[model samples]
Target: MKSIVLFGAGNVATHLFRAISNTRNFRVVQVYNRTPANLVPFQTLVDTTSKMEEVKPADIYLIAVKDDAILPLVKELIFRQALVVHTAGAVSIDALENLDRKGIFYPLQTFSKTKKVDFKNIPICLEATNPQDLELLEELAGSISEKIFRINSEQRRSLHVAAVFVSNFVNYLYSEGEAICKENNIPFEILHPLILETAVKATGMSPLAAQTGPAKRNDTQVIQSHLELLTGDQQTIYSLITQSIQNLHGKEL
Candidate 1:
């Protein structure tokens, strides 16, 4: 079995530890975090440590920390022979350039410690400077997930930006929708079906082809009505998005 030392105790790390532990081919030897309190969750399940010196030798050192923390964390590791990979999406593999066996093992999905995700459905994006290391990552990825992609740093960076637009930006829009509903004394849950349907349709067909509503139809009367109902900040956001939709659909105003 391939032994792994996972760094970080965040959402991604928590999920990965669970998913990887389920597999028979790999085992997480230890979980490392700078803060001792953060290691509590893993202490009962695996070897947990707050010190870099206490880290045990492993076949793979999986760093699942924040993007900014990646480089600084890697510089502190003394293991040069083991394959070291990070779970960051935008950060390039160049961040680990100082190490011999360096790669990226980015999972393309939003993570939350409270939510359980099926790693089998989630896409694991892998990149490595060495061919053998890339194959090793593919093997490890396949152990937990069925979907795997060999993406270079440039492509991975672009994918990360696109993910932010789809996941992060769209979540912000959902919060705005909820706020509007709450202000009107309407149950935000009323929009649940519409939200699910929209998501399903977008996935099943081209989003442009699936497009509908006042913005896409350029229904100026309806658009004006929406703007009038919104707060100042919400009105600005509504106007901007409406204009963007119209522009994409080859319409103005």
Candidate 2:
């Protein structure tokens, strides 16, 4: 069994801490947070510390802080030769201690602080400075997730960029739809079956094949009605996505 230390108590860390603490091979040996108030919830297994010197030793150190904070935090603490890794999808493993040894353990899923994550189906993308450590990461990440991918820093960054469009931006469009429905007194439930069906179809069919809407059908009257309903930025998103769907179908939308 390997001892593990967690270095954040935020959404992703909270979810991971609960998981590691319950797993058989890895233990939450310690945890640290800069804010004293953030230390309270994880006080049980974590030896709370605002001071870096107070953070203890463990086989692996899981740095789960926000991306911008990672570099400065790494500069402040010395890991005492323990393996260290971070969970940022956009940041690279090279951003960690290049000389001291580090890796990446990025989970490809939207992690909302209030929502629960099903680790079973989530894909974990991993990379490391050393092959042995990379193998260890693959093993550890695979234990929690069935999908494990070994990708370099550049590929990870590309995946992150695409994720912003597919995950984050798509959710923004969903919110736009919700707002339009609410304003017209139309229940959003009418779109629920369509949304779920789209997702289901995309699983076995290409996103291009799953594309459906007045845009894909080239029903200009329906598209014009949807455009008229939008006021500002929503109208822009509607125009862009509809254009994209049209381009995909190689016809007017």
Candidate 3:
């Protein structure tokens, strides 16, 4: 079994630990976090440490910390020969150039501590300098996930940007929609079916072909009416998206 050292207790760390711990191929030898309070739960299962120097020797040291904290933590780590990898989407592998063995192990999904996800379906993107390290990462990822890709740092960065548009931006739009629903004294649950169907359609077909709405139909009057109903930030967002959709379909309002 491959020994693993987890260095973060955040959302991604929690999910990754749960997935890997259940597998017989990998064993979490130790967990290290700056906050001793966060390491309390994992203490019962494995060795936990707050100090960087106390981290046990493992085959892989998976850094699941925030993007800004990665490099600083890498500087503090004393692991001389461990394969050090960061689980970040936007961060470049160059951030770990200081380490003897550096790589990336990014899970392309949004993680929430309260929500459970099936890692088997989540795409795990791996990047390494050599074939041996790459195969090592592939083995680790394949143990938990069926979807694995050998994505380079530059490709990973681009994929992260696209992810922001589909996941983060879409979630924000949902929040705005919920606010509008609350203001109108309507239950946001009413949009549940529409949201689910829209997602399904987009996934099944190209988003461009699956597009629907007044904007796509070039219904200028309806767009204008909808824009008028919105105010300030909402109006700006609505207008911008509407214009973009119209332009995409080669239509004008």
TM for every model, in the order presented, reads 0.97, 0.93, 0.97
Q: Model 3, range 137-159, lDDT digits (tens) per residue? A: 99999999999999999999899
Alpha-carbon runs more than 4 Å astray in model 2: none
lDDT of 1 by residue, 90-182 (tens): 899999967889999999998889989999999999999999999999999999999999999999989999999999999999999999899
> What is the C-alpha local distance difference test score of candidate 3?
0.92
Worst 10 residues of 1 by lDDT: 225-234
In angstroms, the error of model 3 at 137 is 0.5
lDDT of all predictions: 0.93, 0.84, 0.92
Task: Estimate, for each residue in 16-97, the C-alpha lDDT of model 2 and write its tens digit.
Answer: 8876766778888787888889978887766667778877887788899989989888887765588889999989777885
The deviation in Å at residue 135 for candidate 3 is 0.4
> Which parts of model 3 are misplaced by more than 4 Å?
none
Compute the lDDT of residue 112 as modeled in candidate 3: 88
Write down the TM-score for model 3.
0.97
Better of 1 and 2 by lDDT: 1
Candidate 3 scores a C-alpha RMSD against the true structure in Å of: 1.0
